[model samples]
Target: MEIITINYPLQGLEDKGPIRPKTLAIGHFDGVHKGHQSVIRRAVDVARAEGLEAAVMTFHPHPKEVLGRGSEYTTCLTPLEDKLERFRSLRVDIVYVVTFNLTFAAVSPAAFVDEMLRPLQVKRAVVGFDFSFGAKGAGRAETLRELAGSDMKVDIIEPLMMDGDKVSSTLVREALAGGRPETAEQLLGVPFSLRGTVVKGEGRGRTIGYPTANIQLAGAYVTPRLGVYAVMAELSDGERYSGVLNVGVKPTFHDSLPMPVMEVHLFDYEGDLYGSTVRISFISFLRSEKKFASVQELIEQIGADALKARSVLSAFK
Candidate 1:
Protein backbone atom coordinates (compact mmCIF):
# COMPACT_ATOMS: atom_id res chain seq x y z
CA MET A 1 0.00 0.00 0.00
CA GLU A 2 1.14 3.55 -0.69
CA ILE A 3 0.94 6.26 1.96
CA ILE A 4 0.66 9.91 0.94
CA THR A 5 0.93 12.70 3.48
CA ILE A 6 -0.85 15.81 2.34
CA ASN A 7 -0.98 19.28 3.78
CA TYR A 8 -3.61 21.97 3.17
CA PRO A 9 -3.01 23.11 -0.42
CA LEU A 10 -2.69 19.50 -1.72
CA GLN A 11 0.72 19.95 -3.34
CA GLY A 12 2.91 17.38 -5.13
CA LEU A 13 -0.03 15.03 -5.93
CA GLU A 14 0.24 15.85 -9.62
CA ASP A 15 4.00 15.23 -9.59
CA LYS A 16 3.26 11.56 -10.19
CA GLY A 17 1.53 12.65 -13.40
CA PRO A 18 -1.88 11.22 -14.33
CA ILE A 19 -3.31 9.00 -11.60
CA ARG A 20 -6.01 6.36 -11.61
CA PRO A 21 -9.45 7.20 -10.25
CA LYS A 22 -9.97 6.16 -6.64
CA THR A 23 -12.88 4.85 -4.57
CA LEU A 24 -12.17 6.46 -1.23
CA ALA A 25 -13.16 5.27 2.26
CA ILE A 26 -13.00 8.42 4.33
CA GLY A 27 -12.99 8.81 8.15
CA HIS A 28 -10.77 9.22 11.17
CA PHE A 29 -10.97 5.41 11.62
CA ASP A 30 -9.27 5.51 14.99
CA GLY A 31 -9.75 1.90 16.10
CA VAL A 32 -10.31 0.33 12.70
CA HIS A 33 -12.85 -1.90 14.40
CA LYS A 34 -15.59 -3.95 12.74
CA GLY A 35 -17.68 -0.88 11.88
CA HIS A 36 -14.68 0.77 10.22
CA GLN A 37 -13.88 -2.44 8.37
CA SER A 38 -17.39 -2.40 6.88
CA VAL A 39 -16.89 1.11 5.50
CA ILE A 40 -13.48 0.27 3.99
CA ARG A 41 -14.71 -3.01 2.56
CA ARG A 42 -17.61 -1.21 0.93
CA ALA A 43 -15.18 1.11 -0.81
CA VAL A 44 -13.08 -1.86 -1.92
CA ASP A 45 -16.15 -3.58 -3.33
CA VAL A 46 -17.15 -0.42 -5.18
CA ALA A 47 -13.62 0.03 -6.49
CA ARG A 48 -13.54 -3.53 -7.77
CA ALA A 49 -16.91 -3.14 -9.50
CA GLU A 50 -15.90 0.18 -11.09
CA GLY A 51 -12.28 -0.71 -11.89
CA LEU A 52 -10.94 2.03 -9.62
CA GLU A 53 -8.28 1.88 -6.91
CA ALA A 54 -9.40 1.60 -3.29
CA ALA A 55 -8.04 4.47 -1.20
CA VAL A 56 -8.51 5.66 2.39
CA MET A 57 -8.48 9.25 3.56
CA THR A 58 -7.69 9.82 7.24
CA PHE A 59 -6.48 12.72 9.39
CA HIS A 60 -3.68 13.08 11.91
CA PRO A 61 -3.32 14.83 15.32
CA HIS A 62 -7.14 14.47 15.71
CA PRO A 63 -9.36 17.45 14.89
CA LYS A 64 -10.64 17.78 18.43
CA GLU A 65 -7.13 18.35 19.74
CA VAL A 66 -6.52 21.15 17.27
CA LEU A 67 -9.94 22.73 17.84
CA GLY A 68 -9.47 22.64 21.63
CA ARG A 69 -12.69 20.67 21.98
CA GLY A 70 -11.12 17.68 23.79
CA SER A 71 -9.31 17.30 27.05
CA GLU A 72 -5.49 17.46 27.07
CA TYR A 73 -5.27 13.77 27.99
CA THR A 74 -7.56 12.59 25.18
CA THR A 75 -5.91 9.66 23.38
CA CYS A 76 -6.62 7.48 20.37
CA LEU A 77 -7.94 3.92 20.35
CA THR A 78 -5.31 3.11 17.74
CA PRO A 79 -2.53 5.60 16.99
CA LEU A 80 -1.87 6.87 13.45
CA GLU A 81 0.81 4.31 12.63
CA ASP A 82 -1.26 1.44 13.98
CA LYS A 83 -4.30 2.66 12.07
CA LEU A 84 -2.28 2.74 8.82
CA GLU A 85 -1.05 -0.78 9.48
CA ARG A 86 -4.66 -1.91 9.82
CA PHE A 87 -5.48 -0.23 6.50
CA ARG A 88 -2.60 -2.03 4.88
CA SER A 89 -3.82 -5.34 6.26
CA LEU A 90 -7.18 -4.58 4.67
CA ARG A 91 -5.37 -4.33 1.28
CA VAL A 92 -6.04 -0.68 0.56
CA ASP A 93 -4.27 0.62 -2.54
CA ILE A 94 -3.61 4.13 -1.26
CA VAL A 95 -3.75 5.97 2.06
CA TYR A 96 -4.04 9.74 2.25
CA VAL A 97 -3.08 11.13 5.66
CA VAL A 98 -4.14 14.74 5.79
CA THR A 99 -2.58 17.02 8.36
CA PHE A 100 -5.28 18.56 10.53
CA ASN A 101 -4.42 22.14 11.39
CA LEU A 102 -6.10 25.52 11.61
CA THR A 103 -5.87 26.26 7.88
CA PHE A 104 -7.04 22.83 6.78
CA ALA A 105 -9.94 22.87 9.23
CA ALA A 106 -11.21 26.13 7.79
CA VAL A 107 -11.75 24.71 4.28
CA SER A 108 -15.32 25.24 3.09
CA PRO A 109 -17.38 22.16 2.07
CA ALA A 110 -17.64 23.20 -1.58
CA ALA A 111 -13.95 24.01 -1.79
CA PHE A 112 -13.08 20.72 -0.12
CA VAL A 113 -15.05 18.76 -2.69
CA ASP A 114 -13.80 20.84 -5.62
CA GLU A 115 -10.12 21.16 -4.65
CA MET A 116 -9.48 18.00 -2.58
CA LEU A 117 -11.84 15.22 -3.57
CA ARG A 118 -12.31 16.00 -7.25
CA PRO A 119 -8.64 16.69 -7.92
CA LEU A 120 -7.67 13.37 -6.38
CA GLN A 121 -9.80 11.64 -9.04
CA VAL A 122 -12.14 10.16 -6.45
CA LYS A 123 -14.98 8.48 -8.32
CA ARG A 124 -16.79 7.03 -5.31
CA ALA A 125 -16.69 7.74 -1.59
CA VAL A 126 -17.72 5.33 1.22
CA VAL A 127 -18.25 6.72 4.68
CA GLY A 128 -20.08 5.90 7.93
CA PHE A 129 -23.55 7.31 8.58
CA ASP A 130 -22.30 9.71 11.28
CA PHE A 131 -19.26 11.00 9.32
CA SER A 132 -18.92 14.76 9.10
CA PHE A 133 -16.34 17.08 7.57
CA GLY A 134 -15.57 20.62 6.44
CA ALA A 135 -15.25 23.68 8.70
CA LYS A 136 -17.18 23.23 11.96
CA GLY A 137 -18.50 19.89 10.63
CA ALA A 138 -20.91 21.53 8.18
CA GLY A 139 -20.52 18.71 5.71
CA ARG A 140 -22.83 15.74 6.16
CA ALA A 141 -23.35 12.69 3.96
CA GLU A 142 -26.10 14.53 2.06
CA THR A 143 -23.90 17.59 1.74
CA LEU A 144 -21.10 15.42 0.32
CA ARG A 145 -23.47 13.93 -2.26
CA GLU A 146 -24.62 17.39 -3.25
CA LEU A 147 -21.03 18.60 -3.49
CA ALA A 148 -19.99 15.57 -5.56
CA GLY A 149 -22.90 16.21 -7.98
CA SER A 150 -23.24 13.68 -10.76
CA ASP A 151 -19.53 13.15 -11.30
CA MET A 152 -18.99 11.01 -8.16
CA LYS A 153 -20.98 8.62 -5.98
CA VAL A 154 -21.29 8.74 -2.18
CA ASP A 155 -22.26 5.73 -0.02
CA ILE A 156 -23.11 6.11 3.63
CA ILE A 157 -22.92 2.93 5.74
CA GLU A 158 -25.51 2.65 8.47
CA PRO A 159 -24.48 1.99 12.08
CA LEU A 160 -23.34 -1.57 12.76
CA MET A 161 -25.01 -2.89 15.90
CA MET A 162 -24.02 -5.77 18.15
CA ASP A 163 -25.82 -7.00 21.27
CA GLY A 164 -28.16 -4.00 21.07
CA ASP A 165 -25.29 -1.49 21.04
CA LYS A 166 -23.62 0.23 18.11
CA VAL A 167 -20.07 -0.89 17.45
CA SER A 168 -17.96 2.27 17.75
CA SER A 169 -14.67 3.60 19.00
CA THR A 170 -16.39 5.29 21.94
CA LEU A 171 -17.79 1.96 23.09
CA VAL A 172 -14.42 0.28 22.69
CA ARG A 173 -12.72 2.98 24.75
CA GLU A 174 -15.35 2.76 27.44
CA ALA A 175 -14.99 -1.03 27.62
CA LEU A 176 -11.23 -0.83 28.00
CA ALA A 177 -11.46 1.99 30.56
CA GLY A 178 -13.93 -0.05 32.56
CA GLY A 179 -11.64 -3.13 32.48
CA ARG A 180 -14.02 -5.13 30.34
CA PRO A 181 -11.67 -6.32 27.61
CA GLU A 182 -13.94 -9.25 26.76
CA THR A 183 -16.67 -6.82 25.76
CA ALA A 184 -14.19 -4.75 23.76
CA GLU A 185 -12.96 -7.84 21.96
CA GLN A 186 -16.51 -8.85 21.08
CA LEU A 187 -17.05 -5.44 19.51
CA LEU A 188 -13.60 -5.27 17.83
CA GLY A 189 -13.46 -8.87 16.55
CA VAL A 190 -10.03 -9.08 18.20
CA PRO A 191 -8.48 -8.86 21.62
CA PHE A 192 -7.70 -5.44 23.04
CA SER A 193 -3.91 -5.06 23.12
CA LEU A 194 -1.18 -2.70 24.25
CA ARG A 195 2.31 -2.52 22.75
CA GLY A 196 5.32 -1.34 24.71
CA THR A 197 9.04 -1.67 25.20
CA VAL A 198 10.36 -3.51 28.23
CA VAL A 199 12.03 -1.15 30.69
CA LYS A 200 14.03 -1.63 33.92
CA GLY A 201 12.06 -1.66 37.09
CA GLU A 202 12.82 -1.67 40.86
CA GLY A 203 13.55 -5.46 40.73
CA ARG A 204 10.87 -6.04 43.30
CA GLY A 205 9.16 -8.77 41.33
CA ARG A 206 12.39 -10.73 41.07
CA THR A 207 12.96 -10.45 44.80
CA ILE A 208 9.52 -11.94 45.33
CA GLY A 209 10.41 -14.86 42.99
CA TYR A 210 8.00 -13.68 40.30
CA PRO A 211 10.14 -11.85 37.77
CA THR A 212 8.27 -9.38 35.61
CA ALA A 213 8.89 -7.45 32.43
CA ASN A 214 8.05 -3.82 33.00
CA ILE A 215 6.66 -2.19 29.91
CA GLN A 216 6.73 1.42 28.78
CA LEU A 217 3.82 1.94 26.41
CA ALA A 218 4.73 3.31 22.95
CA GLY A 219 1.78 5.62 22.31
CA ALA A 220 -1.07 7.40 24.05
CA TYR A 221 -3.32 4.32 24.09
CA VAL A 222 -6.39 3.96 26.22
CA THR A 223 -5.35 1.90 29.26
CA PRO A 224 -7.43 -0.71 31.02
CA ARG A 225 -8.53 -0.09 34.55
CA LEU A 226 -5.99 -0.64 37.35
CA GLY A 227 -6.03 -4.38 37.96
CA VAL A 228 -4.47 -7.75 37.37
CA TYR A 229 -5.48 -9.39 34.11
CA ALA A 230 -5.06 -12.65 32.25
CA VAL A 231 -3.11 -11.82 29.11
CA MET A 232 -0.94 -13.12 26.33
CA ALA A 233 2.36 -11.42 25.53
CA GLU A 234 3.96 -11.57 22.10
CA LEU A 235 7.65 -10.80 22.18
CA SER A 236 9.64 -9.14 19.40
CA ASP A 237 10.99 -12.50 18.26
CA GLY A 238 7.45 -13.74 17.52
CA GLU A 239 7.14 -15.95 20.56
CA ARG A 240 3.90 -15.74 22.51
CA TYR A 241 3.36 -16.73 26.15
CA SER A 242 0.40 -16.76 28.48
CA GLY A 243 0.87 -14.35 31.36
CA VAL A 244 -0.60 -12.43 34.26
CA LEU A 245 -0.38 -8.66 33.87
CA ASN A 246 -0.58 -5.97 36.49
CA VAL A 247 -1.52 -2.39 35.78
CA GLY A 248 -1.08 -0.24 38.86
CA VAL A 249 1.25 1.41 41.36
CA LYS A 250 3.00 -1.16 43.62
CA PRO A 251 1.12 -0.34 46.76
CA THR A 252 2.71 -3.10 48.80
CA PHE A 253 6.25 -1.86 48.31
CA HIS A 254 6.18 1.85 47.54
CA ASP A 255 4.19 4.81 48.71
CA SER A 256 3.71 5.87 45.11
CA LEU A 257 5.40 5.86 41.69
CA PRO A 258 5.67 8.48 38.99
CA MET A 259 3.10 6.61 36.93
CA PRO A 260 1.14 3.36 36.84
CA VAL A 261 3.25 0.45 35.65
CA MET A 262 2.44 -2.43 33.31
CA GLU A 263 4.24 -5.54 34.49
CA VAL A 264 3.78 -9.03 33.02
CA HIS A 265 5.03 -12.32 34.39
CA LEU A 266 5.18 -14.98 31.71
CA PHE A 267 4.09 -18.35 33.01
CA ASP A 268 6.97 -20.87 33.23
CA TYR A 269 9.28 -18.73 31.10
CA GLU A 270 12.77 -17.45 31.80
CA GLY A 271 14.84 -15.14 29.59
CA ASP A 272 16.31 -11.69 29.32
CA LEU A 273 13.45 -9.62 27.80
CA TYR A 274 14.75 -6.19 28.69
CA GLY A 275 14.90 -3.69 25.81
CA SER A 276 12.56 -5.80 23.70
CA THR A 277 9.12 -4.69 22.53
CA VAL A 278 6.10 -6.77 23.51
CA ARG A 279 2.45 -6.68 22.60
CA ILE A 280 0.13 -7.80 25.38
CA SER A 281 -3.46 -8.80 24.66
CA PHE A 282 -5.94 -8.61 27.46
CA ILE A 283 -7.86 -11.84 27.94
CA SER A 284 -9.85 -11.16 31.10
CA PHE A 285 -9.87 -8.98 34.16
CA LEU A 286 -8.64 -11.00 37.14
CA ARG A 287 -8.80 -8.64 40.06
CA SER A 288 -8.58 -4.97 40.99
CA GLU A 289 -5.33 -3.55 42.35
CA LYS A 290 -5.23 -3.09 46.09
CA LYS A 291 -2.80 -2.38 48.92
CA PHE A 292 -1.38 -5.21 50.96
CA ALA A 293 0.08 -5.00 54.41
CA SER A 294 3.20 -7.07 53.75
CA VAL A 295 5.27 -8.25 50.80
CA GLN A 296 4.51 -11.88 51.68
CA GLU A 297 0.79 -11.21 51.41
CA LEU A 298 1.29 -9.65 47.98
CA ILE A 299 3.31 -12.64 46.81
CA GLU A 300 0.64 -15.04 48.02
CA GLN A 301 -2.06 -13.08 46.18
CA ILE A 302 0.09 -13.01 43.03
CA GLY A 303 0.43 -16.79 43.20
CA ALA A 304 -3.35 -17.09 43.32
CA ASP A 305 -3.65 -14.63 40.44
CA ALA A 306 -1.16 -16.62 38.37
CA LEU A 307 -3.06 -19.83 38.94
CA LYS A 308 -6.31 -18.15 37.91
CA ALA A 309 -4.69 -16.63 34.82
CA ARG A 310 -3.38 -20.02 33.77
CA SER A 311 -6.83 -21.47 34.20
CA VAL A 312 -8.36 -18.68 32.12
CA LEU A 313 -5.80 -19.12 29.33
CA SER A 314 -6.20 -22.89 29.25
CA ALA A 315 -9.37 -22.60 27.17
CA PHE A 316 -7.46 -20.88 24.35
CA LYS A 317 -5.08 -23.79 24.05
Candidate 2:
Protein backbone atom coordinates (compact mmCIF):
# COMPACT_ATOMS: atom_id res chain seq x y z
CA MET A 1 0.00 0.00 0.00
CA GLU A 2 1.13 3.57 -0.66
CA ILE A 3 1.53 5.71 2.44
CA ILE A 4 1.35 9.44 1.83
CA THR A 5 1.92 12.11 4.45
CA ILE A 6 -0.18 15.15 3.57
CA ASN A 7 0.72 18.69 4.62
CA TYR A 8 -0.20 22.30 3.70
CA PRO A 9 2.96 22.69 1.65
CA LEU A 10 1.78 19.97 -0.70
CA GLN A 11 -0.71 20.59 -3.49
CA GLY A 12 -3.44 19.02 -1.33
CA LEU A 13 -5.75 16.93 -3.47
CA GLU A 14 -4.87 18.48 -6.80
CA ASP A 15 -1.39 16.98 -6.67
CA LYS A 16 -2.93 13.57 -7.20
CA GLY A 17 -5.74 14.33 -9.61
CA PRO A 18 -4.81 11.19 -11.52
CA ILE A 19 -5.59 9.08 -8.44
CA ARG A 20 -9.17 10.38 -8.13
CA PRO A 21 -12.18 8.15 -8.52
CA LYS A 22 -10.98 6.18 -5.50
CA THR A 23 -12.92 4.38 -2.79
CA LEU A 24 -11.97 6.10 0.49
CA ALA A 25 -12.45 5.16 4.11
CA ILE A 26 -12.22 8.09 6.55
CA GLY A 27 -11.58 7.96 10.31
CA HIS A 28 -9.01 8.77 12.98
CA PHE A 29 -8.68 4.98 13.34
CA ASP A 30 -6.78 5.30 16.62
CA GLY A 31 -6.61 1.62 17.42
CA VAL A 32 -7.84 0.25 14.11
CA HIS A 33 -9.61 -2.43 16.07
CA LYS A 34 -12.48 -4.65 14.94
CA GLY A 35 -14.76 -1.65 14.50
CA HIS A 36 -12.25 -0.03 12.17
CA GLN A 37 -11.75 -3.32 10.36
CA SER A 38 -15.44 -3.30 9.50
CA VAL A 39 -15.19 0.15 7.92
CA ILE A 40 -12.05 -0.70 5.93
CA ARG A 41 -13.57 -3.98 4.75
CA ARG A 42 -16.58 -2.11 3.41
CA ALA A 43 -14.33 0.39 1.69
CA VAL A 44 -12.41 -2.41 0.02
CA ASP A 45 -15.67 -4.00 -1.09
CA VAL A 46 -16.82 -0.71 -2.54
CA ALA A 47 -13.52 -0.26 -4.32
CA ARG A 48 -13.69 -3.75 -5.80
CA ALA A 49 -17.28 -3.43 -6.98
CA GLU A 50 -16.79 0.07 -8.37
CA GLY A 51 -13.41 -0.76 -9.98
CA LEU A 52 -11.49 1.91 -8.07
CA GLU A 53 -8.52 2.08 -5.72
CA ALA A 54 -9.00 1.88 -1.97
CA ALA A 55 -7.59 4.56 0.34
CA VAL A 56 -7.79 5.46 4.02
CA MET A 57 -7.86 9.10 5.17
CA THR A 58 -6.70 9.77 8.71
CA PHE A 59 -5.62 12.76 10.84
CA HIS A 60 -2.18 12.84 12.44
CA PRO A 61 -1.17 14.22 15.87
CA HIS A 62 -4.84 13.47 16.53
CA PRO A 63 -7.16 16.45 16.16
CA LYS A 64 -7.25 16.78 19.88
CA GLU A 65 -3.47 16.99 20.25
CA VAL A 66 -3.23 19.49 17.41
CA LEU A 67 -6.15 21.83 18.04
CA GLY A 68 -6.73 21.07 21.74
CA ARG A 69 -10.29 20.38 20.71
CA GLY A 70 -11.54 17.87 23.28
CA SER A 71 -10.76 16.15 26.53
CA GLU A 72 -7.28 14.65 26.38
CA TYR A 73 -7.04 10.88 26.15
CA THR A 74 -4.09 8.61 26.81
CA THR A 75 -1.62 7.64 24.10
CA CYS A 76 -2.51 5.70 20.94
CA LEU A 77 -3.39 2.09 20.23
CA THR A 78 -0.81 1.84 17.47
CA PRO A 79 2.13 4.11 16.59
CA LEU A 80 2.54 5.60 13.11
CA GLU A 81 4.54 2.69 11.69
CA ASP A 82 2.26 0.09 13.26
CA LYS A 83 -0.94 1.89 12.18
CA LEU A 84 0.19 2.11 8.58
CA GLU A 85 1.20 -1.54 8.66
CA ARG A 86 -2.31 -2.47 9.82
CA PHE A 87 -3.82 -0.56 6.89
CA ARG A 88 -1.42 -2.27 4.51
CA SER A 89 -2.39 -5.63 5.98
CA LEU A 90 -6.02 -4.78 5.21
CA ARG A 91 -4.94 -4.43 1.57
CA VAL A 92 -5.64 -0.72 1.35
CA ASP A 93 -4.19 0.69 -1.86
CA ILE A 94 -3.25 3.98 -0.24
CA VAL A 95 -3.07 5.63 3.16
CA TYR A 96 -3.33 9.43 3.38
CA VAL A 97 -2.06 10.70 6.72
CA VAL A 98 -3.24 14.30 6.85
CA THR A 99 -1.46 16.68 9.19
CA PHE A 100 -4.04 18.13 11.58
CA ASN A 101 -3.14 21.81 11.92
CA LEU A 102 -5.22 24.86 12.82
CA THR A 103 -5.66 26.03 9.22
CA PHE A 104 -6.75 22.61 8.05
CA ALA A 105 -9.08 22.22 11.02
CA ALA A 106 -10.70 25.55 10.17
CA VAL A 107 -11.91 24.30 6.79
CA SER A 108 -15.67 24.03 6.62
CA PRO A 109 -17.45 20.80 5.72
CA ALA A 110 -18.27 21.97 2.22
CA ALA A 111 -14.78 23.29 1.61
CA PHE A 112 -13.23 20.04 2.86
CA VAL A 113 -15.28 18.04 0.41
CA ASP A 114 -14.43 20.38 -2.40
CA GLU A 115 -10.73 20.75 -1.64
CA MET A 116 -9.85 17.29 -0.32
CA LEU A 117 -12.40 14.63 -1.21
CA ARG A 118 -13.33 16.04 -4.62
CA PRO A 119 -9.70 16.57 -5.56
CA LEU A 120 -8.91 12.95 -4.66
CA GLN A 121 -11.63 11.98 -7.13
CA VAL A 122 -13.37 9.94 -4.48
CA LYS A 123 -15.89 7.76 -6.27
CA ARG A 124 -17.16 6.27 -2.99
CA ALA A 125 -16.55 7.14 0.66
CA VAL A 126 -16.86 4.83 3.68
CA VAL A 127 -17.15 6.00 7.27
CA GLY A 128 -18.36 4.83 10.67
CA PHE A 129 -22.00 5.48 11.46
CA ASP A 130 -21.06 8.20 13.96
CA PHE A 131 -18.33 9.65 11.73
CA SER A 132 -18.10 13.43 11.47
CA PHE A 133 -15.62 15.72 9.70
CA GLY A 134 -14.78 19.31 8.72
CA ALA A 135 -14.41 22.31 11.03
CA LYS A 136 -16.19 21.93 14.38
CA GLY A 137 -17.36 18.52 13.16
CA ALA A 138 -20.21 20.24 11.30
CA GLY A 139 -20.22 17.54 8.63
CA ARG A 140 -22.01 14.27 9.16
CA ALA A 141 -22.84 11.43 6.77
CA GLU A 142 -25.94 13.31 5.65
CA THR A 143 -23.99 16.49 5.07
CA LEU A 144 -21.31 14.60 3.13
CA ARG A 145 -23.92 13.17 0.77
CA GLU A 146 -25.38 16.59 0.19
CA LEU A 147 -21.96 18.02 -0.56
CA ALA A 148 -21.12 15.22 -2.95
CA GLY A 149 -24.43 15.73 -4.76
CA SER A 150 -24.82 13.08 -7.46
CA ASP A 151 -21.11 12.92 -8.17
CA MET A 152 -20.05 10.43 -5.43
CA LYS A 153 -21.24 7.54 -3.28
CA VAL A 154 -21.16 7.59 0.53
CA ASP A 155 -21.40 4.50 2.72
CA ILE A 156 -21.96 4.92 6.44
CA ILE A 157 -20.85 1.67 7.97
CA GLU A 158 -22.74 0.79 11.13
CA PRO A 159 -20.93 0.61 14.45
CA LEU A 160 -19.57 -2.76 15.43
CA MET A 161 -20.89 -3.82 18.82
CA MET A 162 -20.05 -6.50 21.35
CA ASP A 163 -22.12 -7.41 24.39
CA GLY A 164 -24.60 -4.70 23.27
CA ASP A 165 -22.01 -1.88 23.48
CA LYS A 166 -20.12 -0.17 20.71
CA VAL A 167 -16.51 -1.34 20.35
CA SER A 168 -14.31 1.74 20.43
CA SER A 169 -10.68 2.74 20.95
CA THR A 170 -11.54 4.56 24.18
CA LEU A 171 -13.01 1.37 25.59
CA VAL A 172 -9.95 -0.58 24.54
CA ARG A 173 -7.66 1.96 26.24
CA GLU A 174 -9.74 1.79 29.38
CA ALA A 175 -9.65 -1.98 29.35
CA LEU A 176 -5.87 -2.09 29.04
CA ALA A 177 -5.38 0.55 31.71
CA GLY A 178 -7.66 -1.40 34.00
CA GLY A 179 -5.71 -4.62 33.28
CA ARG A 180 -8.64 -6.28 31.56
CA PRO A 181 -6.56 -8.04 28.90
CA GLU A 182 -9.35 -10.34 27.78
CA THR A 183 -11.72 -7.48 26.96
CA ALA A 184 -9.01 -5.54 25.10
CA GLU A 185 -8.14 -8.66 23.12
CA GLN A 186 -11.78 -9.09 22.11
CA LEU A 187 -11.92 -5.58 20.70
CA LEU A 188 -8.52 -5.82 19.02
CA GLY A 189 -9.12 -9.31 17.64
CA VAL A 190 -5.61 -10.01 18.85
CA PRO A 191 -3.45 -9.71 21.94
CA PHE A 192 -2.61 -6.21 23.22
CA SER A 193 1.05 -5.69 22.33
CA LEU A 194 3.95 -3.28 23.04
CA ARG A 195 6.87 -2.94 20.64
CA GLY A 196 10.14 -1.24 21.49
CA THR A 197 13.87 -1.62 21.21
CA VAL A 198 15.62 -3.46 24.01
CA VAL A 199 18.08 -1.29 25.92
CA LYS A 200 20.73 -1.68 28.64
CA GLY A 201 19.55 -1.80 32.22
CA GLU A 202 21.19 -1.70 35.67
CA GLY A 203 22.21 -5.39 35.31
CA ARG A 204 20.33 -6.18 38.51
CA GLY A 205 18.26 -8.89 36.85
CA ARG A 206 21.49 -10.35 35.52
CA THR A 207 22.98 -10.53 39.02
CA ILE A 208 19.79 -12.32 40.11
CA GLY A 209 20.45 -14.95 37.40
CA TYR A 210 17.43 -13.83 35.37
CA PRO A 211 18.84 -11.42 32.79
CA THR A 212 16.03 -9.53 31.08
CA ALA A 213 15.52 -7.49 27.97
CA ASN A 214 14.82 -3.88 28.92
CA ILE A 215 12.56 -1.96 26.58
CA GLN A 216 12.10 1.76 25.96
CA LEU A 217 8.67 3.14 25.12
CA ALA A 218 7.72 6.01 22.84
CA GLY A 219 6.30 9.20 24.28
CA ALA A 220 2.73 8.56 23.13
CA TYR A 221 2.60 4.91 24.11
CA VAL A 222 0.30 3.75 26.90
CA THR A 223 1.40 1.09 29.37
CA PRO A 224 -0.64 -1.36 31.34
CA ARG A 225 -0.96 -1.67 35.12
CA LEU A 226 2.25 -1.79 37.13
CA GLY A 227 2.64 -5.49 37.89
CA VAL A 228 3.94 -8.81 36.68
CA TYR A 229 2.40 -10.27 33.53
CA ALA A 230 2.68 -13.44 31.50
CA VAL A 231 3.61 -12.28 28.00
CA MET A 232 4.73 -13.57 24.61
CA ALA A 233 7.71 -11.85 23.09
CA GLU A 234 8.24 -11.69 19.34
CA LEU A 235 11.85 -11.10 18.44
CA SER A 236 12.87 -9.01 15.46
CA ASP A 237 13.44 -12.24 13.53
CA GLY A 238 9.79 -13.28 14.10
CA GLU A 239 10.57 -15.96 16.68
CA ARG A 240 8.15 -16.11 19.63
CA TYR A 241 9.08 -16.80 23.24
CA SER A 242 7.13 -16.85 26.47
CA GLY A 243 8.26 -14.78 29.45
CA VAL A 244 7.34 -12.94 32.65
CA LEU A 245 7.50 -9.14 32.57
CA ASN A 246 7.83 -6.77 35.50
CA VAL A 247 6.31 -3.33 34.83
CA GLY A 248 7.37 -1.21 37.76
CA VAL A 249 10.25 0.06 39.85
CA LYS A 250 12.69 -2.21 41.68
CA PRO A 251 10.75 -2.21 44.90
CA THR A 252 12.58 -5.30 46.13
CA PHE A 253 15.81 -3.26 46.25
CA HIS A 254 14.31 -0.60 48.53
CA ASP A 255 14.69 1.93 45.76
CA SER A 256 12.38 4.94 46.08
CA LEU A 257 12.67 5.93 42.43
CA PRO A 258 9.31 5.67 40.66
CA MET A 259 10.42 5.20 37.08
CA PRO A 260 8.01 2.82 35.37
CA VAL A 261 9.89 0.12 33.48
CA MET A 262 9.43 -3.13 31.59
CA GLU A 263 11.85 -6.02 32.00
CA VAL A 264 11.14 -9.37 30.33
CA HIS A 265 12.95 -12.64 31.08
CA LEU A 266 12.59 -15.06 28.20
CA PHE A 267 12.03 -18.66 29.17
CA ASP A 268 14.41 -21.35 27.91
CA TYR A 269 16.34 -18.94 25.69
CA GLU A 270 19.66 -17.11 25.69
CA GLY A 271 21.16 -14.65 23.23
CA ASP A 272 22.31 -11.04 22.81
CA LEU A 273 18.88 -9.37 22.36
CA TYR A 274 20.17 -5.95 23.32
CA GLY A 275 19.73 -3.26 20.66
CA SER A 276 17.11 -5.40 18.90
CA THR A 277 13.40 -4.50 18.72
CA VAL A 278 11.05 -6.87 20.48
CA ARG A 279 7.28 -6.94 20.53
CA ILE A 280 5.64 -8.17 23.71
CA SER A 281 2.04 -9.33 23.61
CA PHE A 282 0.30 -9.31 26.96
CA ILE A 283 -1.58 -12.51 27.74
CA SER A 284 -2.78 -12.15 31.34
CA PHE A 285 -2.02 -10.29 34.54
CA LEU A 286 -0.28 -12.45 37.10
CA ARG A 287 -0.04 -10.27 40.16
CA SER A 288 0.34 -6.73 41.44
CA GLU A 289 3.72 -5.14 42.13
CA LYS A 290 4.92 -5.68 45.66
CA LYS A 291 8.02 -5.14 47.75
CA PHE A 292 9.73 -8.32 48.76
CA ALA A 293 11.53 -8.88 52.08
CA SER A 294 14.85 -9.85 50.52
CA VAL A 295 16.64 -10.85 47.30
CA GLN A 296 16.08 -14.51 48.19
CA GLU A 297 12.31 -13.98 48.46
CA LEU A 298 12.20 -12.06 45.17
CA ILE A 299 14.15 -14.83 43.45
CA GLU A 300 11.72 -17.44 44.74
CA GLN A 301 8.73 -15.48 43.45
CA ILE A 302 10.35 -15.03 40.06
CA GLY A 303 10.87 -18.79 39.83
CA ALA A 304 7.16 -19.25 40.51
CA ASP A 305 6.27 -16.63 37.88
CA ALA A 306 8.38 -18.47 35.30
CA LEU A 307 6.53 -21.66 36.07
CA LYS A 308 3.14 -19.96 35.74
CA ALA A 309 4.13 -18.20 32.54
CA ARG A 310 5.20 -21.51 31.05
CA SER A 311 1.79 -23.03 31.84
CA VAL A 312 -0.13 -20.11 30.33
CA LEU A 313 1.93 -19.86 27.16
CA SER A 314 1.93 -23.63 26.57
CA ALA A 315 -1.50 -23.42 24.95
CA PHE A 316 -0.48 -20.39 22.87
CA LYS A 317 2.55 -22.21 21.49
Off by over 4 Å in 2: 9-17, 69-74
lDDT leader = 1
lDDT of every model, 2 decimals? 0.91, 0.86
Per-residue lDDT of model 2, residues 178-211, tens digit only? 8877788999888888789999988898898899
Please, what are the lDDT tens digits per residue for candidate 1 over residues 144-166? 98889999999999999998999
- TM-score for predicted model 1 compared with the true structure: 0.96
Best model number under TM-score: 1
User: Backbone clashes per model, in order?
Assistant: 0, 1
Deviation of model 1 at 272, angstroms: 1.1
